[model samples]
Target chain A: MTAARTEDDLKTLMLLSLDGDEGAYRRLLHAARPLLVAYYGRRMSGAAQADVEDLVQDTLLSLHARRHTYDRTRPFTAWFFSIARYKLIDHHRGRGGRKAAETQLHDKIEDDFSAESLTARLDLDRLLDALPPAQREMIRQVRLEGRSVAETASSRGQSESAVKVSIHRGLKALAARIRGEA
Target chain B: MRKTDDIIESLVGDLKPVARHALSRRFLVAILSSLAVSLVLMLTLAGLRVDMAVALTLPVFWIKAAYNFLIAAIALFALYRIARPDGDTGPVFREIAVVVALMGVAAVFQLALSPEAVYRRLILGHSALHCPFLIFAFALPVLVAAFLWMRAAAPADLRQAGFMAGLAAGAAGAFVYSWFCTENGMPFVLIWYSLGILATGLLGLLLGPRLLRW
Candidate 1:
């Protein structure tokens, strides 16, 4: 079956929007709305649908503001998730630190296309093996499984901040390694 | 970490297309450019075939123009529909090159014979550039090649979801040029336009691998 809406499609639309096509921007907003609703609803507990709706509106606004940072020709979900994930973190950080064991995190960045997709195309399983376990795990849990930092932290018994920090550092390290800069 | 490209690209699908661009503008440009070229050539022919020059204002002149534009538009539209902007272009170019190289040979033969002498000859004209030989033997095929290569390499990336945009543009350009053109109805438009289009297809086939290689 055709896979879910991928990111490249979104990138194309965003680029078109940048080129003065309001139509593309409209498409981008439409596609990202559902994602925002599901994202906020899943993470916020005891929160009403209105809360999620508010978050969706907020996320779309933020996306519109920062859409320039996004690159065309990449996956929309990954970028969208990255934005959503950041919005989620901002939400948590805004609410003061999480409770001792209840701290959760999620990342919406789509790092999968550049790495896993390329790996599959190149069939470089051996190269993937070269990554340190923690770094690789971060990549897998966030990029592959579509988990947020909060979810990963909750599952792994790590602090939410720690999870976010690790993911940030891990991706940096992975980039260095991939580019032979390590 | 893995799918940076995918994650980054995902934002666009979130977008909804709000408008559609018609092929007419680009088509008009094609017509204008081609006609400009044809007019210059037609004027040149006036020195030789004054009768033909007088006939240019006749409705038959428009028939030829319309015919060429239609032929180019259809071929381009088909190509746009079938082309996958995201799909691999390497193999596509390999196929295209073979076709173009063969046509290049035919274009050489076409250059040797006089279209006027064979089809509409009562006089002769010459040019260092932009002649029938130059356009058919050179410009036509070259433009075709460029059009195909551009699509295979880098499409307009406009919001429009069609692949044949370049071909259509080329047809518009070529059709206008055809308005000024005369071939030995020996090489009907089928032969000429097809050859021109195939040459572009071939160009894409030959160069897309390198031009669009990631």
Candidate 2:
């Protein structure tokens, strides 16, 4: 597909996903993976395949977590590539790479990727599984199950504020896990 | 590692419509509420200038208030943009530079038009020693509020975001304190007030990587 057509397609999928269309969201992620893989592969030519795949997965996770920050009025590709570039720079910085080279590379990757084909694998269930049962349960209900805090609070015999705090702390802990701090 | 497909499945399993403009709303609410707190704090601790009616009638008082308010407004705009994952802060930085340069020009003009005898007094008002520190102190609540809300957002450059947060809080603090500050010199506001805002921004820079890791 042409770049303009691809941008339109992804933008439509993203809008649909934001409107809570599961099918559209899945397609969006699926569509994003290959572009991410190709993008990372080009930058990290000397890195292991697993490392590149990990970066791709990390980028995807960040995209999922930060999807709400995407402004509908902006180009979808710009938003996607910004997150991708951030993760790339973050990956290098975490590994003690040269700052000047990283910045030069950053400028080089300013353009968005064209549609391409590739495959990769990764997971988050392990991190979730490591959380305390109560925290895990709270996160699952409010975050994954789409339940209101009040409903979860009532069902769990806890105050609404307590449920809110639990979810907040739980998410914080989950974030710590993602950062490898826990 | 688990399958990427499985991860995608889990993510899509229970998707919900995120509230539109939620990020900006949270940021606005955070800054404004904390500003209100700082105002209350200043009122309780120092009270307004003794000659409030007289101060209100003077153009110098409004100039001081406007100087601080303008910085707060621009810095807040920068903070808002930097809080987003894809938000660019380049334009905001240029805008802030423009505001500061304008203030610098105003200070120079104010000095040139006045007699040289009072230059020192104009620059170093009675509250010179405490003004910047007090501005920093009043900014704490707003800084904390900005940081707390910012943790929920994805800022690409943590230090830059933190600096903007501090800059915003500091200018806001100065603006709130302007009501109680009796100093009517443009040089005093430009120098001491800017120092306070710079100190807060430095503090934010130091704390960004640690407190804003998420």
Candidate 3:
């Protein structure tokens, strides 16, 4: 309870989550991720410990799915652990597991620009499209290209603040375009 | 297997972004399961009642139909909340309400019809949603199951765990609720039944840490 901020506060968070505030639910799930990671790590080979993180994410999913089953009157930790424990049982009980696939680290993005996407307009390529070629290059180099603004300024033989201003304007213009577009 | 510390940290941080999406889907599943139970009750229990003599009686038939319709209507109304990606049930009351409505339908139907007949038509005969209630129930589950199946198939890591864990957890939760659950009548459903289903969530949580492992 020492690291708990306040025991009563944590309890209230539990109560709020069980009561169904989406934001609180998200916080509750995230807060428990570390615990699940540690718990799953204990059951795994050291080299495979990273898989514990996967277990944490999976627990979030199941908790999300089964959240409705939680009674507000109960302790959040107790309710939270109940699902986690069951998931652990199933993980062990499961047999004939497949070997991990060697896949690219980068996630695949669906090319479809459906209206359903929340950040569909935020696609970097699309955002850059609205900027002039030099402005885009300046911004990309200093930002996505990961050069510091000073380095970018020096490379372009411009002052750092001027480079900053150029990049800032470029981003602003892009934002305006997209905001208007949206 | 690079085992580089930097790469591990990078990937770990990158994957954090996807967790919210995973949770949202799981929330959908949790809501769907309870809804499925209610749908089944609503469908099969049409023209349903607790007292057979009263159930089949014309006046009672309409009452049962209205009850079934109201349950379905509530589910439909709640279904709208579900359709809004960001909106979802806030507490266990919804879970219990759905269950109680479903169970109420069953109780009333049981009263009107013997368990033998109900089982004969549903289990023994293998009737696939022959009645309206059954049709509606089956429809909702089938649609939900399909969406979930497709979703799991396409995801980076299939959460076969979500469903498998959900069902097992659901049953376990029901078991726990049987302890705290007081079977009074409709009010029990309106209040206590939700408590029971929320209790089912306890099983989910107990197992979540292990079950969610990729």
Candidate 4:
């Protein structure tokens, strides 16, 4: 389920904002509000809605301060999500300065968040499905599971070079698929 | 629920961005100006290598210069990318690794091509012990200048940002040092030059959390 806002719409609004269009900037933030809520909502399920709202506002303020740093050449979401991720990491760190316990909780939260809602939000599975089985499996193992090519190669009984090639080609194809060029 | 309108109101009320186009310009100014300072310092303090006239005529000299310049350029590109909150250093890192690996190969190739006794001489140049320190010394000014400019932006990954700053400064320093350093051996560049860069990178890593706290 994609947000009601399309990537194009977000880009258009951001472009307008960059051009000194304050109205467009407001509208862009307005448009982002619900998506941001949904974003924080999913990760922070069972937690107070206020916490999610606070995080959303925090991210928006951060975006304001950092807007100039945005490169016009790159995708807005990559820039946006990275900011969100940082804020989330900071949020966790601030609340859970309990040290060792904090890392476990953070990892658990990350896995829980990404496994379902995040994957669906990004449409990762559909893109993966479009790839050939070998490439798809390669991407899943290497990219998703964070397995080394050497390890994956040994397990799959393939040469390390072959594994590396597959991972490279797989990611390239995935990017093409995301761009609708596949 | 708190009103989204209120947040929007607060954001738009007096929000002036640092200016979008100005960011790139600022970065360019930082790198160029710092590099200029480093170059001036090197020229004044050490002067060019004694064989400067002879070295300028050699293709190997140009090749080595190209290698150092490319490393700096690549690191600068990486730094520029990560200047933004969302910039990813993963791909840039691979490119850097590939570049360093090629340098290693070039060093080995130079070793193999040269006579057997030349190995020790190439690896341990007259200035082998002092080259890394010199490079590190040159890198300091660039690193400080870079961090000053970089502090204006809000980087999410302070350590990485600092690391990038260090890498960029180190590369720039090495590039400048190439003029003063008479050592042509690839091993000298690979070992001493890299260690110098690494030292700066470590310094950046150490300072990142403190400097880029925001």
Of the candidates shown, which would achieve the greatest DockQ relative to the real structure? Answer: 2
TM-score (C-alpha, index-matched) for candidate 1:
0.33
Candidate 4 global CA lDDT score:
0.78
lDDT of 4 by residue, A91-112 (tens): 7666676363357445854564
Q: Best candidate, lDDT-wise? A: 2
Better of 1 and 2 by TM-score: 2
Task: Pull out the clashing pairs in model 4.
Answer: none
Query: What does candidate 3's lDDT look like per residue over A1-182, in tens digits?
Result: 12222224445655565554545444454446655664466455687676666566666666555544444444455455545544544454453232222111112112221222312322464568568887888987878658898888888889988888888999888778878988
TM-score per candidate? 0.33, 0.76, 0.30, 0.73
User: Model 3 chain A, poorest ten-residue lDDT window?
Assistant: A101-110
What fraction of the native alpha-carbon contacts across the interface, defined at 8 angstroms, is recovered by model 3? 0.00
lDDT of 4 at B176: 89
- Which 10 successive residues of model 2 chain B have the least lDDT summed? B84-93
Off-target runs (Cα >4 Å) in candidate 3 are: A1-124, A130-134, A140-158, A161-182, B1-51, B54-184, B187-192, B204-214
TM-score order of candidates, best first?
Answer: 2, 4, 1, 3
Fnat for every candidate: 0.02, 0.66, 0.00, 0.53
What is candidate 4's fraction of native contacts?
A: 0.53
Q: Chain A in model 2: its TM-score?
A: 0.54
Evaluated at residue A8, the lDDT of candidate 2 is: 69
Docking class of 1: incorrect
lDDT of 2 by residue, B155-174 (tens): 87888989989998998999
Taking every candidate in turn, the Cα RMSD to the unseen true structure, in Å, is 16.9, 18.6, 19.1, 12.6
Q: Where in model 2 is the C-alpha error above 4 Å?
A: A1-5, A97-182
